[model samples]
Target: MKYVIILGDGMADEPIEELGGKTPLEYARTPVMDDLAGRSEVGLACTIPQGMKPGSDTANLAVLGCNPRQYYTGRSPLEALSIGVDMKEGDIAIRTNLVTLSEEEEAYEDKRILDHSSDEISTEDAAVLLEAVRKELEEDAYHFYVGTSYRHLLIWSKGSVTELTPPHDVLGQRAGDHLPAEEKLRAMQKKSYEILSKHPINLERKAKGLNPANSCWFWGAGTRPSLPSFEGKYHKKGAMISAVDLLKGIAVGTGMANIHVEGANGGLHTNYEGKAQAAADALLKDGFDFVYVHVEAPDEMGHQGSVEKKVQAIEYLDERVICPIREALDKAKEPYRLLVLPDHPTPIRVRTHTSDPIPYLLYDSEKELRRIGAYNEREARISGILVEQGYELIRKLFEN
Candidate 1:
């Protein structure tokens, strides 16, 4: 038996009056998913511990069978690793965002847009700035490199003290003034500002009228993490299908292959169907027993409070992605299984990833269909399986 895990990033909801008091999931006409739920043993599973309000890093770690506290180095460092950036101990790694800083206003990381130029961060532009930052902004124990747009990786020397939060999470929200990691980190942020403030890079960007990512707002600092592979646990080749660098990094770190396809984007504005098909095809051709597909657009739509878009995205998955995969499985000469669910809820109310456990449906010929169903979390509790966590779900899928 093979496992196909389809994770809609930030998939979950709050009460939407527009749907006559139903959450987006409940209101959306997910006929394909519903049909699968009917044919297969359905279940609502917990992705994380209750009341913990874990981030994607923690939740994904859990789903992959790794304890977050034991192994989560940080999201940005994970992204760095996905991008082939090797991190050493004492290296302060940050997930930097390309942002526009205002000269007339006191700049904070949240003020800048998390995504510049939609979702595409030009490699040439990123490389140029990375070189400049590496050349000019050298503190005794600090170094830097640009990751994706509005994202970067920083390394601080061992024994250097720097106290600061990684800038990746502060997107369009208020990040409270937490104490810096250490003096070194604080100094690094300051020096980064000093050099980047009206520096040639920014000036050139300004002259070109491009978004100037002036100062570096660092967060999620940690050394390299040690994690065991899911391959060992399940004894089957698996692949992580995601556009997010962090997820890809986790796949790479855990000895899984990451299939990168063109026209795939992690931002909310990208094409959802294209991504899903690419992932499904990649998994099918590679003979991977498990394929983990993650979609970020719905979460973005939820965060933006675009109920219509969220519903549409859900339907799109059902029509173009979910339904097609089901058909593919039917056509396959061998039996297969598909698990459809979300990692966490990015409610329209909260506009950020939340710890809400998501509803799910497991489709296979062996499992009997059930009448108990609803796409929402509460309703899923009475659905099929309803396991406590995702690790056990994946484990079960691989067991057969």
Candidate 2:
């Protein structure tokens, strides 16, 4: 049987009183998910283990059945792999975000972090900004590589993974409090601001009332990654469809094919229909054993604390992605086992990833479980089926 996983990143959320006390998933019209939940084995899975930060890097690894405790190297290394950057053992990979800081007459540290994603600046514009940073900051050791949107990469030859805060984690906080303690990294960051703040591009963005990607904030650093081959472990020829480099990097390191869909940006307006079509083609036309489709919009909206947009994103996932793929599989007579879930909760309250137990649904086309409740956190919790080891949950999809 073929296998599929439609991962809605950061879809899970705590109940919001504004939405009639219902979470986004609870309020969103997810008819396909509701119907699938009726015939699917629904329950909660702890995708993030205790003592581990609830970054998508660790959580998605668990969803794919790779124990993060053993396999995860660092978040940036995975994105580096996705970018085809061959890193040596001593090379440290760090994620660099072109962020926006409030303009004020205080110390650089006193500037409040206005935006982590620089208002989700276009990659085309971000590339120009990064090029400026590279010319000004590149040295014998540290070099910058342009990635998608505000998310970029930096390779520090024989560098250290010192303490640095994720930009998203400290939204609206004083920049000084979270700046890297390491002198060299801090110096580079300061230089990046100087290089970008007055660039012609920032002036253009300012004129248009857009958040200028004024500063470079770095985090999620680590050495090179070495993951066990997914084919060797699962014996399935798998493919990954995602716009995020981190997921693509994981697929690359694990030897899974990366299916790039045109117009598939990892944002609210990302090409949802294109991603669904790609997964269907990879499974039916290409004859892959498994396909994983990850949608990043929901998580992104959650991080922005935009409940309305998060609900809209969930609706698009159910309609544009899930419904089309399900119909394609059915029409093609491709009997498949499908699993649907979020990597973790980016609760609106905190606007960041949390270690809370997210819900999961596993549907076997051959033998319908026909269980209770819709596909959501509350309903899944009511099922009372908890998978303590989230990494083992993928095995359930392949099991007979």
Candidate 3:
């Protein structure tokens, strides 16, 4: 049977006093997911190994059964490769977060600022910003190329591979509060940030009264990722719908066609339909046997502590994306299996990806369907098949 995997990035969470200490997953109205949980054997799965760092890139490697420390190149390179950016030997590509940072808005300087968010940046606008970033880097001796969203790529022709960390992300946040790279890279990242902050695009957005996502937050710096393809390893064609360049890069680097969607949003406020419809269409195409649908909006909403938006996105995925696909599969009588899970939790309290165990559920015609349970991490612990890592989850889906 074929597999339909849906990843809700950063969907898990810690208790929040706002919801009387219940995580967003617990408080949200995920009736469809709950129904699936009740009908199927529910369980918890760890996409990443325990006590190790947790982010989509590394965890996704684990899901693909590859070790991040051993296999991860970096997120930007993944995005760079997905968009057809050719990377050669000794080239380093980084995924830059084109985020807005204002000192007047929130408590956390890095987490919440006048803006400190992503996803509002449009694809066209992102291209413009990337060009601006490229123009300013003429004398640095490092090659800079911008990709989709706020993500750009950096190639260090003269530096050692070990001289940098991945750009700022959940993985970067784990290193230290917000120190620019050690010494040599520090000045570079700082200048890069300034150039992005004052770019013409930010000025244009600000003039229009829109949120100006000025400033580039560069983290998750990595060299080119080298991994085996789906056709090479599993003999099946695969595709993934994810906003992060890292994830997209992985798909492309591994020889999978990266599915680009119009109006696909990444951060707190994003387009739900775009993400869902993209996955649906990919599955409907005949040659694909595995489809990985990664949703970032839910995770972003949870990180912002916007319980309402988080719930709305979850429901949107259910009604608009998941439900429609389920219906299509049913009508076509496609011999397929659906696996649902989260990479890790970006709880409201933490506001970043965590190592906490996330929930997972697998549905096929062979198993007895269970009713959906409450929306929360704890609910899945007792309900679904609690596999320990991403590879295990993959095994469960493919098990006859």
Candidate 4:
């Protein structure tokens, strides 16, 4: 039987007053998901292990049936794999984001982190800005490589995996308070602001009223990673469709095929239909046993704290991604088991990842379960089917 997982990253949320006291999932128009909930096994799964940081790196590993405590080396290492960074022992990989910092403060420390994603700056423009930083700061020990959009990578030779706060976690907060404790890393970040704040790119962005990619925030530090092959462990030749590097890195490490779709940016306006079509092709034409489709729009909107956009993103996932994949499978007369869920909650209230158990829907094409209410946090919780171990949730999809 064919298997499919449609992951809406950070799709879960708490009740928002602006959303009429309903979470985005509850408030949004997700008719497709809501309809499937009637015949699907709907429940909650704790994607984040207890005490682990509620980041996508750890949660996704859990969702894919790999225990984070065992397989997760670090977040950047996974992205490094996607960037094709051949990390050596003792070398450290750090995520370098082209972020926006408040320009009012003369001292970099006093400035606030205005935007973690720098208004989701284009990768072409970001690459140019990163190149400038590379010329000024890159050395034999430290090197910068541009990834998707605002996400980039920094490989530090013989560097420590120092604790650094994610910029998204402290949005609208004093930048100095969250700077890395390591003096050298902190110094580099400070230097990055100096190099980018008054650059031509910043001036142009300012003219256009766009958040300037004015600083480099480093976080998610780690060494090289080693993950067991998905095919070997699950006996399914899997494929991954995602716009972000992190998911692609996981696919790289897990021996899964990374299906690239043109114009599939990790943003609200990304090509959702392209991702859906790619998954359908991988399963129907490529002879792949499993396909994991990840959509990042909901997570991005959640980080921006846009309640309306987050709701719209969920609707897009329902209409443009989930609906198309299901239609393609049914048209092909394929017996498939489809699983839908989020890795974790990037709550609109908190504007960051939360260690909350996310709701999930498991549907089999051949068999229909008893009807449940619409797919939302409340209904999933009411179903009384809680998977305490998130990694085991994947096993349930593969077996029976």
Segments in model 3 whose C-alpha atoms lie over 4 Å from true places: 103-119, 162-177, 182-184, 193-198, 207-209, 267-271, 274-278, 370-375, 383-385
Q: Write the per-residue lDDT of candidate 4 for residues 1-400, one digit (tens) a residue.
A: 8999999999999999987899999999999999999999999999899999999999899989999999988899999999899999999999999999999857898999989999999999999999999999998999999899999999999999899899999999999899999888899999998899889988999999999999999999998989999999999999999999999999999999999999999999999999999999999999999999999999999999999999999999999999999999999999999999999999998899999899999999999787958999999999999999999999989996
Candidate 1: tens digits of C-alpha lDDT, residues 1-400: 6678887777778778888888877788888887777676666667776654456777787777776656776666677788887777666566554444444465442234342222334555666666666787666666676565555677666744334443333444443253255655555554555566566666777677666665555556556777787788678788887777788888988998887756556655555666666656766776787888777667767755679889877777777677777677666654777878887787877567766667777777566566656555556766445677555666655565
What lDDT does candidate 3 reach at residue 2?
A: 64
Q: Which stretch of 10 consecutive residues in model 1 shows the poorest summed lDDT?
A: 109-118
Highest lDDT model number: 4
Tens digits of per-residue lDDT for model 3, 1-400: 5678887787777777777777777776677777776766667877777656677777877776576667776666676776677777767665556666553433333543333354357778977876776687545546667665656666665454543433324432422356454564556555555677667877888888777766555566666777877777777688878776667877877777778776666764555667666666777755687888877777777656677777676667676667777777767777778888777787766566778777877788556565646545787776645676566567777777
Q: List the residue pairs that clash in candidate 2.
A: 109-176
Better of 3 and 4 by lDDT: 4
As for lDDT, the candidate ahead, 1 or 3, is 3
TM-score of every prediction relative to native: 0.83, 0.99, 0.86, 0.99
* Model 3: lDDT of residue 3: 72
Per-candidate clash tally: 26, 1, 33, 0
Model 2 residue 158 lDDT score: 89
Q: Which residue ranges in model 1 land beyond 4 Å of their true spot?
A: 50-53, 100-103, 106-132, 159-184, 187-215, 269-274, 384-386
* Model 2 alpha-carbon drift over 4 Å, by segment: none
